[model samples]
Target: MTTDHPRTPGPRPTGATIVWAERVTKTFTTPDGRELPVLDDIGFHLAEGEIVALLGKSGSGKSTLLRCIAGLIAPSSGTVAYRGEPLTGANPGVSMVFQSFALLPWLTVQQNVELGLHAQGVGEQERRERALKAIDLIGLDGFESAYPKELSGGMRQRVGFARALVVEPDALLMDEPFSALDVLTAENLRNELVGLWEGHEAPVKSILIVTHNIEEAVLLADRILVLAANPGRIQAELRVDLPRPRNRQDPHFESIVDTVYGILTGREDAAVAAVEPTTTGGAERPAPTPTSAPLPEVSVGGLAGLLEILVARGGEDGLAEIADELNFEIDDLLPLVDAAELLDLARTEGPRIRVTDAGREFAAADILTSKQLFAHHAASRAPLVRAIVQALAATDGHTLREGLFLDLLRRGFSAEDARRQLDIAIDWGRYAELFDYDSGDGELTLDPGAQDAL
Candidate 1:
């Protein structure tokens, strides 16, 4: 974060449990009346004054778990306790910060900070004092009267922190609060927060943050809880025992980052849980096809771009080094890597991703040739794409109603997810020239000889 204030560890934790979750499970009913499990039998605890980070991919239910702990949502089953008391509703002692700076344009910095105090039925005079105190505490003293519109993104987020602190909360919950800011700004804010926590200037005693950034978790939290997707489960708990004011280049810091990377990319159980079993002649298939899932929202051009980077790096380690070099999270990088693997352009195992022979051929080709190769692999390798083409080919008119794909998708996906998968298919199909979709009548036509778009 910032260097104006030196870093130090916060007050020593008292070993008293502040928040607890026991066998928590969250399930949602899809629009089609099917149950979709987002979280399954998760359990965790936060000690007094301890900072815990929930790290996972986008759909891993990390945010949902945070919401449950914050009492913003009721878990389908299980118990959440704060200070040995069951948290039934919005806990009065908790404050929350979010990725989006949810500030009112009409409110000035002071007024916005005072909003929470006002809701608590606090007196106007006291609200003014606490709001100003928090504003000054969070390094926003000089901008008391500035409207949200007058402040930059970083400044707006400072106001959010001030507002959350004005209540003198016992615990703070942050959901990707730093994600929207630029790199330098986010680092500065993180350091400043560490400063506050160490100095015991902030009112909150404990924090639980949701983030996908691996290094950020190591830098801020004492413990990191990695969640797995497809009915999210707690896959691993890592203790970041490194000293504070952590050096980004230190070997220990690098080691911890690497450890988390291994857990995230190499957890075989997580991979197993995400697959579906299909029977062929009464025997279940061991490996599920990647194409059965939604296609990644990456273009062939994007895949080529990443391949160029791996080639430049001489087939480097997949997650940590590349992500650090590019200032990207595993969440942002994995989709492209996964897409490449599914298309036989690259192979990733553990934390390393290497370009395959097919990948090198595609990389060496001109744009037109690349698309042709991409078209061939997409039609042959991707199960969903292959199924669509075969369906269209088998049809009398070499066409089918587009909704048929959506219906097939719904059996395995939520409505929102089904829609996303369909959109991805449409885009990839158009790029590969595998099919022509007519928006006017919602039809997909097989176009085997579709000309080169490049």
Candidate 2:
């Protein structure tokens, strides 16, 4: 795939600004009454004749930023403007496509596509005509009368696209619109979208897509904004200079993907340069506490699998290559990478992760030896694991209810998240043979030799 049409990267807008967000910050009140910051002073603009991707990991608040741009929600303190007009409610200039098809089950494809037009008070005849055109445009012409349940995942998503496009807004907002489909299906849709945009067939003037897939961002976006987690903020921005219909195997394309991966993994200088030295408002970040330090939700087997792969790759490989080979999104690999790093079993050098000697030995050891090695590392390195061990060790009976830990975790995480954290901790602890959990009793009991591993 290749294209003669070249797009310059960066903030150099080729057309008028369609949507702009300035210093947008969003905060949410958790069920525990804790104020959780999602977006931190985020700012960006979408201009006509461009596709921009908001790229990041799961916690980067990419969707939150997109919602704020759509005027579905107000920023905690900032402004969202559509063509110089500050938004007080839904921005009338844009329509959105969501990951979940979001089609009403009872509505026919035509009815679904006509939803926005109907809401905008379009006349019945005009709405039907336009809906038919959009349905045909999106390749669902014959399926106009088909119910959602009768459509495949791809067809269902096409209905979603038709629904958004039928509105003919100034900008199209997509929140991971292809993530729910199969790889081939997603690729097909992406290529079709690019074709529509390049051929001047798309109704909208600009497109804003939120995604966690690095290659997808490189594939379709003219500009990519890489966001960092922990109060999501823009970490780096890259302008893709490659022509449209990019080939995944192209060196330039692969290089751009690698660069973005580096920025995401904290290896690229661009990320370091974009990162603020202090917290937003110039306030210093607090030191990490046991509860505050999030555990990547990965199992012991998952972490071990990643280490084994690294070892097979001669102890290191570029993150992008690993993800591509394994048919995984970089986001899928992130938690395992995080877990390995947390346990000191792996270390990242730029865009590549290298397994530590400790990791190699653990991988090579027998089952009991592996457990002992893991226990030693878990007790010494993993904060949550160490906290659990220490708490149990200090108790006379060396047993405690799970609720005790969940309570402490709630100070940092929501109730559901707290449980997930504890569950991961329990898995790690049980695998290392450092503790035993009885689910029926909801209790964790320290194993007799737990302290010896520490």
Q: How many steric overlaps are in each model, in order? A: 3, 0
**Residue 219 lDDT (model 1):** 94
Q: Can you write out model 1's per-residue Cα lDDT over 205-297, one digit (the tens) per residue? A: 888999998889999999889897767898888777876778878988877776676666644543333333333275665544432345777
Least well predicted 10-residue stretch by lDDT in candidate 2: 1-10
User: What would the per-residue lDDT of candidate 2 be over residues 250-325, giving only the tens digit for each residue?
Assistant: 9988878777877876664647554445443667778555665678888888888898888888999988789889
Off by over 4 Å in 2: 1-13, 268-270, 273-292
Model 1, residue pairs in steric clash: 1-187, 1-188, 1-191
Q: Give candidate 1 regions above 4 Å deviation.
A: 1-11, 266-286, 289-292, 315-331, 366-369, 411-414, 449-454
Candidate 2 Cα RMSD after full superposition onto the native fold (Å): 3.9
Task: Evaluate residue 246 in candidate 2 and report its C-alpha lDDT on the 0 to 100 scale.
Answer: 90
Q: Superposing all C-alpha atoms, what RMSD in Å does each candidate have to the true structure?
A: 4.8, 3.9
